[model samples]
Target: MTTSKRPQNRADWQALAETLIPSLETRAFIDDAFVDAASGETLETLNPASGETLAHVASCDAADAELAVAAARAAHARGDWARLAPAKRKRVLLRLAELMEAHKDELALLDTLDMGKPVSSSLGDMAGAIGSIRHQAESIDKVYGEVAPTGDDSLGLVLREPLGVVASIVPWNFPLMMTAWKIAPALAAGNCVILKPSEKSPLSALRLAGLAKEAGLPRGVFQVLPGYGHTAGKALALSMEVDCLSFTGSTQVGKQLMQYAGQSNLKRVYLECGGKSPNIVFADCKNLDKVAKRAAAAIFHNQGEVCIAGSRLLVENSIREAFVDKVVEAAKAMQPGNPLDPESFMGAMVDETQYRRVLDYIAKGREEGAQLRAGGASLEGPGYFIPPTVFDGVTPAMTIGREEIFGPVLSVFGFDSEEEAVAMANDSDYGLAAGLWSQDIDRIMRVSRRLHSGQVFVNNWAGGDQTVPFGGVKQSGNGRDKSHHSLAEYTELKTVWMSLQG
Candidate 1:
């Protein structure tokens, strides 16, 4: 209805922000119908940018989740999605991707409003999500099953089949992209999916279900349940009929979901959880300037709600002060701006609770005696905005250095050697991801191998694609999200042994 509101320039974006009263669609899609849950309740989804109500989403409950699961089961039993040929499934997903591309700007704007991320960054997220969908769609028919070597009288076949009724609980940080990461492969493998997006940001997921339906995905094949995790997410997890649960959120929540799975049907649970990823800056042969800039970006991107945010910065003692100064300068440039502004590199925190939590961490840093070198205050704005804060002299024991702050706050530590840096980085409850800025190939190889992290970025932080496997280790949770490896999570491998003598 408001195609003209699609911003083409900074001025246009700014104008749209000022005058836009976007009437966002918010409803639970079950059995291909847009309506409320059984209880007939609604919840207000607010714009994180201006703290205004964006949409009133359907507040789905356990009963609604049950209805959705029943629909999915019916669809699966009827051979609507789970029995489709891989190529046909790919076509449906590809069409969905095309539609997503056609309305990318609309989706991007919805995400920006819903989660307080910069509109420019939301566009990137839309691109990533769409790319993920298309790639998984194209890959559906390409990957082949395996043949096993067996005894002389026996033939063995290893076949991969879709695990029916995959339910996902995606986080709010990168809602659309994370949704794509979880559902695309599952759908491509020919499974019905139930997505319960984070209550903090559910608009995009609700909108996405419509796009999927319009793209010709069968009823009940893909459903979006918009509600709190404790309600819909718990209900989906506790269902004995649901086959698998893939989640991306806090480590604590992930562990709880795993318990819920065990308490119910023992559905396979795949979790990609929290991270306090370390960004190690060795006294390399070159490029402190570039690394400093990247370091700043790594922690501050998405207002630091990123699961693999390089929150802990380990700087070689030699370049500590100078590198930190460069980082501080970089942070200064990333000042929080209106989310609708195309030029706003850093926007508000996702919501008020997270905003308060971040501020609490900053206080903890000061109370623990870590030197607050840069920003240590929240920005004066309507929405939740925190200045990019840096804390130097942050020891491993300090709260700032150990915890996943989930804010645009950096904890700086000095490392004497590569081994020490590796030790400090690994000395955490999490082993999700780590990043290093060094030119020595041997050091790079050795440190990367030695670090206890799922993903190691050689010269960058949190950089990769759908082609690469992305996941974490330790308390950061298990299972990969992207690549061919992710496809395995949604499928169960059955070994078929046939006797030739029979």
Candidate 2:
């Protein structure tokens, strides 16, 4: 795979996309080649931006999953990857990263067409994915095993070894980025990986398979199975041959995977699941205007499909009305537009089902008596698009305030004091992420420490680099991703002690 000339602007991108859409790879990649499902069945992948069928992708099921698992098992046993030298593995992964960077434009375009996210956003996401791979590759040789403390007559060693087979099931919201987050570390640790991408956005993963092959990954070392969650996803989770299952999606599905793991081989399951994160704004915060802009982007970005989106906004009562007004204006400016257009800030929902689900939540907000402040109706068009919707005067008991809508909807609540704000933010089943804006260092530290979230941002919203660990507690699921911490999940720690008696 090599770099191709990319389009410069919206019109150019639209023209280029027309030529690329017709030739996308739509079959599963198994054992380093694209193959049809064993059942010979295919599923139609729709473009949410235009409500049109992009391609008929091979619909893999349990049988295909079995094939993938067998390949992974064989690859692990063959020792071509799992037993390879760390330096050699690092070189292969570095080459893969280079290939991904070379063909980033094509990968980004496929994600945009398949999932209805803005092309600009996909491009940025591709950069993150590529960088993650590079980071993992570079860290391969740097990870050191430990020599445990022991008496002179005894020797103790702690070793980190790769889990045999890793099945990565990623969500459509950030397909490439999330997939990279899982597979890069697993592969960097010299493990065989089988990726089951969301049926809604499988193109990027399918495209990525060929690059893996081009970068010298052994046959059967990496594969992509594209199918429904109940079929392909369940098969991977329940397979006895799989040694680890890493997933990012809804909490409900995460629980199912856990059950499957228990029923099967008790594979190591690492999940980063759903969230109804809160963004608390204190009265002592300086720069209300900056806070309002960040608040809008935190919830409204990616069309509010983000699992860590700041959907619940907690504001101090003294600035609740004024802050919401500014947020509303910012939301108004982020109207839905053609995903191919670089200028578009927001795009259509992933599909009609999610589109209607968000709409149903909006209707429930109205029925539950939350005050509607901004856009509420769905946009009249062929695509599944809903403009940013804001609901003020929301109580903690309201449906919109408590649930994860997973759309561009904001529920606002007012609190009288810092204690009340912290309480409101912690009042959720999810503890994935939270945000608070305050100038006072004492308040920022106090509130940040008390929030029941895995990651907290003060004076910003979801602003963290790849070096930071990302995960959640409670229902948001277990295990972490990113940085050296994520690498631990893909590996197992073993201690060996030897006695030296002469």
Off by over 4 Å in 1: 1-6, 14-22
Give lDDT per model, in order.
Answer: 0.89, 0.93
lDDT of 1 by residue, 34-53 (tens): 88778988887788777888
lDDT of 1 at 141: 90
Which residue pairs does candidate 2 place in steric collision?
none
What is the per-residue lDDT of model 2 for residues 1-502, given as tens digits with 9 covering 90 to 100?
3336677788877777787778788899998889999999999999998889999999999999999999999999999998999999999999999999889888888899999999999999999999899988988999999998889999999999998999999999999999999999999998999999999999999999989999999989999999999999999999999999999999999999999999999999999999999999988888898889889999999999999999999999998989999999998789889998888999999999999999999999999999999889999969999999999999999989999999999999999999889888998999999999988998888988999999998888888777898999989989898898998788899999999987
- Give, for candidate 2, the lowest lDDT window spanning 10 residues: 1-10
Task: Flag clash pairs in model 1.
Answer: none
Candidate number with greatest TM-score: 2
